[model samples]
Target: MRSGARAVLALGANVGHRAQTLHAAVEALGATDGITVEAVSTIVETAPVGAVPDQPDFLNAVVLVRTDLDPHALLAAAHAVEAGLGLDRSTKVPDGPRPIDVDVIAVGDLGDDVVLDEDGLVLPHPRAHERDFVLGPWAELDPDAVLPGAYGGRVVDLLTRLHHGEGPA
Candidate 1:
């Protein structure tokens, strides 16, 4: 682990004390070793997006962090934060309601070309640019944010394209 690699994390919740859980999750993340919380986007509430959709709205936010941990370690740290906040992954259904969700949005800068396609992790979050829940808050925190990948682009531009139904076909 080094000292200043930037990473983006997305937090969400729809069960229990949603806002409180998110806040705690952020704090816990900041407290973790090899990670430093930088900025957090204003939490936004939105309807769930996925196959299992009969659930309550979710409060989501984006977190900017300076981390020394590698991608997989960062992911493990995120999962730890999720579990500490009452998210039982084994019992949780995909897209189902949960107390917390910590998503690894992106690691490293656009020029770095940080791409990862390992067994349990994918860099730049394959669907980040397409989901407003992630982009909206991300744009709020970083207007110039550029998602790096085959389906990637400027955060604000992607959000605009999504609203216009102009996503890649």
Candidate 2:
């Protein structure tokens, strides 16, 4: 990432003081040097995505950021943010709700098929195409950045569909 490269981050949480966790995440990210939060969508409550549902709904939001840090560094910073807020790595259930969940949605101008996680950053998120928790709030910030072709629907359209259908928790 250069001086002007921007990335979108998707955040969600459903357990143990959710709203406060969201606030903490925003604060932590904002506090990280070389990173500036450009935009933030409203904190919306939605059901959890994927399985292992024995939990409550989540407060989800998307953050647009301008950073000079590379995608891998930014991802490390995000993980630090989560850990700073008390994320237990011991939890084995993947995608399962917790005190906080921060995901790298898109980085700079990366492609959908590209894998950033191997480089310590993930883009277009591995499961973003199937997640309303991420897509709904994400669309609020950068609807045009949504995937193309089969996923041509604007973020708003996806949000609407999710709200109208069985989505998020």
Candidate 3:
């Protein structure tokens, strides 16, 4: 495994062979030269996390990858996987159904104050601390992981609670 920093990527799929897409995503990340998958959280059945309604349940998981790529590059690679798997991103939408959703949850050794935003990608994934779908698998992968927000230890704690309930929203 390439040793730079480990990043937790949250994967969610609600349509079209969710398990296969998740597995393919793992393969795709492994396919990248600079990124090697270290561990993957077990698949979690979750509810929608936003205002979207009447959508199918999602199959979500967190993947811990050891990578040397910067946050933007890693995000771009994830977007590429979604695109390669037929996720449409031509429109500006939110919380709706999709083929696959991949997001960078946390980065290894980064303090809570770290954040990134360029083009469309954001580090610590803007909503990770508040969403169970992200935090559930995230905590499952790294129970002691710190987030990029001010939630401190509260976020992970809340995650353990929400994880037992529904995803979000």
Candidate 4:
């Protein structure tokens, strides 16, 4: 059997039962073949980012998973989990509120600074370092987590810097 690669995922939901949607997404991910959820961060509620004004606040969390699937397959699995939870990206406005949102933030060490602009995927989630919703929960799950590449730094440090107005705008 091939060794599983470690990947980080960010999850959020602002519509319906937010908490339940997030939890269910995690569970669904674990149920997929070749994907094993290793660690999950505590859920945090935060105001929407990039949403239309007056949009509902979101329930957000981060998860670490081990998967034998390659990066592309892993991404597809993440999207599948989102779709299963009622996230219809095709019809939803970008950054809009949703039943569930699952993003592949990074994929192993290869994800460090590696830029891939495929049709529907991007690695290292270009703006992850700038978002408290992503970094905060990530730090909780892996204090030693480093973004790697040009955005190099520990997750906790990134979150601290972002909190203090030092991170990217």
Candidate number achieving the greatest lDDT relative to the actual structure: 1
Tens digit of per-residue lDDT, candidate 4, span 1-169:
4478889999999999999999899999999998999999999999988747578999999999999998888888988998899988789888887899989888888755575657457677888889899998888888888876567568888888888988663
Off by over 4 Å in 1: 110-119
Greater-lDDT candidate between 1 and 4: 1
Give TM per candidate: 0.92, 0.82, 0.85, 0.93
Error of 1 at 141 (Å): 0.7
The C-alpha RMSD of each candidate to the native structure, in angstroms, is 2.5, 3.6, 3.1, 1.9
Off by over 4 Å in 3: 111-115, 154-156, 161-169
Steric collisions counted per model: 0, 6, 0, 0
User: What 10-residue stretch in candidate 3 is worst by lDDT?
Assistant: 160-169
Candidate 1 is scored at a TM of 0.92
lDDT for each residue of candidate 3 in 59-158, tens digit (9 for 90 to 100): 9998989989887788888889889988988862688888888887767655454656465655556677677777767777777776655554545776
Q: How would you encode candidate 1's per-residue C-alpha lDDT over 1-169 as one tens digit per residue?
A: 5477889999999999999999999999999999999899999999999988999999999999999898889999999999999999889898899999999989886333355556368777877877999999999998998888777888899999989999741
Query: Which residue segments of model 2 deviate by more than 4 Å?
Result: 117-120, 148-154, 157-169
Global lDDT of model 2: 0.75
Instruction: Indicate the residue-level lDDT of 168 in model 2.
Output: 24
After superposing all C-alphas onto the true structure, candidate 2 shows an RMSD in angstroms of 3.6
Q: Model 4 off-target regions past 4 Å?
A: none
